[model samples]
Target: MRDFFEVRDVHVMRSGAHGPLPVLGGVDLRVGRGELVCVVGPSGCGKSTLLGVVAGLLRPARGRVLLAGRDVTGTPAHTAYMPQQDLLFAWHTVLDGVALGLRVQRVGRREARARARDVLAEFGLEAFADARPDELSGGMRQRAALARTVLQGRDVVLLDEPFGALDALTRLDAQRWLAATWRAHRWTGLLVTHDVGEAVTLGDRVLRLSGRPAVVAQEVAVDEPRPRTPGVPDERVVRTVLAGLGVVPDERAPDEREPDERAPGLPVRLP
Candidate 1:
């Protein structure tokens, strides 16, 4: 695959309770043009940190970020990044919030809101265009945030648990919507998700990272078609990701296997 967006040997260190803490250790990632790739790893791993570096929000200690083969380290304008939170300003109207990116691009506020209102309709938020974020539902807020990111017209998009804050049902709904939206936009995406199913459903490939200053441990190709329904992750691909994260279900019958093995949401460890 052509490396449209690449992170090479990235190393990140953040101030922690105990001096500088290593977050990413020699992480390398490559995504083809317009490919949606999912990244999964142990909790507290450098997943979010990796996205920060790739988005140019945080400069890596030792590595380079490339977009279409152009080095763009410490340049935040190259990509549109939607972090874990919806992060909609409560004071700004839905239209204004969605228009923030365009305004940042030097588009006049009047023209930006005009464009934002049009996009809000696409997200089914036209009726609430004048409403504040507090007046909108969680799903609606997320949609507005996404519309804003997409309006930036960046070729690369980074999503950090975009649906993690939503409830299960809402998350499922958001996932479905995002999949369809992504299919339509076809922007190159790098999403950090803990749900193996979400990764399989949305990603063309899944990368598993090991913890303690994370590093890529395995890469699992997802051969499924796009616009896949959310909540129904492919067993084949999910198992591959989980197994890569060192999670294995006991084949023995329930009577013989350990209870934890039979339980749902088994804790997967990274070695």
Candidate 2:
């Protein structure tokens, strides 16, 4: 089957204080229709920058972005992006916040709000529909933001550390919630996260990126079926991914050390 979304030989450079700095160097990726792919990399390894390029928020110096066989380079209309923070409008009610996308599409206020309410109900946020951003918990806020993203009905969703800010328990809840939601709608998703366990649990495949001008170092297929529980990914898969990223000692190492005892959410140093 033809790929649903693709980033072909993408190269992105940014102007730093001193000079030009390369963020992505000849990066290539593809996500099939109804597939969920998670990208895990060291902190400041240009994961978010890569997502921005794909979302058309930033243009790559070279290479093309294709969505469902159509080239959409530098076109933000083709995808919906949800950043690390929920960025909810503090003044607007939860319902209105979720309805923002539809309203932007020239949907009537009444109709947009009705659609938002239905989706919010599906997300189990109906009771908080009238609540303001401040009134909802951190998890609820993220859920509301996701509702807005889904309401846009875009073919691809770019999530940049969407659950990074939540507490352990809350993040787990959000992960499971997102996985179930994705299974229901099956919109192609590319999520950039630092949590290895999260990637293993939520993604159909996890891509590990490393180095200064990062490229895909390895792609580990989850193989497990979804509706997966958060924080409970297959230990073997997690170990394989960590080893590929050099987060854990490689089995081939002559003097292999015990697996790192650090918690799952801690940042993995780039080699």
Candidate 3:
């Protein structure tokens, strides 16, 4: 059966000052319907680039991006992308911000605001409806941004470190909220994050990318139940993903190391 989402041997390059710089090297990935897939890689390994390609914001040098078995390369209609930054417009109220997508879709301002209010209440941000982006806490801002994304009603949501900027406690809160929200509305998701525990806790499967011009180094399936408690990822899953990323040293004896076995390449270390 065809996957709900597919990235087939995708390759991307950008023109650098010196010349062409390769970012993604023959990348292939897929996410089944309603599956949340987390991607971890060293910084500058083109994680965001991959999401951009999937989001149809960037055209791949080679390969195809398909949603629901139809090619959607360079067409963003199939996906909703939320970047690392909240990117909320300060002038827009929380309600207006969340309603932006609907408004863009030609929803009447009154109707958009009404729908936005409904989602805001669902997101527990109704009280902050009139708040500016600067007035809300980091977590609240992200929630507002997410509410906006969710309002797009897209089946695929691409998240690039959505909670990376929050404080540890706030991050945890955001994770719990996100997990619960995702569970209730099971959109196929691809999250790009450096947090191993986050990946383990939130993703149905975690894919690790390594080396410059990265490729998938490993894929770890997380068997834990959803709406997972924040901060405490399944220990075994965490260890497996951490080990794959070289965040944790292997316990093998020195003599057992094969000459052909290469060390894991990590772009960034996770806490």
Candidate number achieving the greatest lDDT relative to the actual structure: 2
Backbone clashes for every candidate come to 0, 0, 1
* Model 2: CA > 4 A from native: 252-271
Give candidate 1's error at residue 194 in angstroms.
1.3
Residue 111 displacement in candidate 2 (angstroms): 1.1
RMSD to the hidden true structure, all candidates: 5.8, 5.4, 4.1
Clashing pairs in 1: none
lDDT of 3 by residue, 204-252 (tens): 9888887668777677779887668889999887876676667887565
Q: After TM-score superposition, what is the CA distance of residue 211 in candidate 2 from its true location, in Å?
A: 1.8
List TM-scores for all candidates, in order.
Answer: 0.89, 0.91, 0.91
lDDT of 2 by residue, 71-102 (tens): 99999998889999999999999999999998
- What is the per-residue lDDT of model 1 for residues 145-260, given as tens digits with 9 covering 90 to 100? 99998888897899999988899999888888788788888899999999899889899988888886787777777887765878888887786567556687534467853343
Could you tell me which 10 consecutive residues in candidate 2 have the lowest summed lDDT? Answer: 261-270
Clashing pairs in 3: 42-267
* Candidate 2 lDDT for residue 265: 27
Candidate 3, which segments miss by more than 4 Å at Cα? 252-271
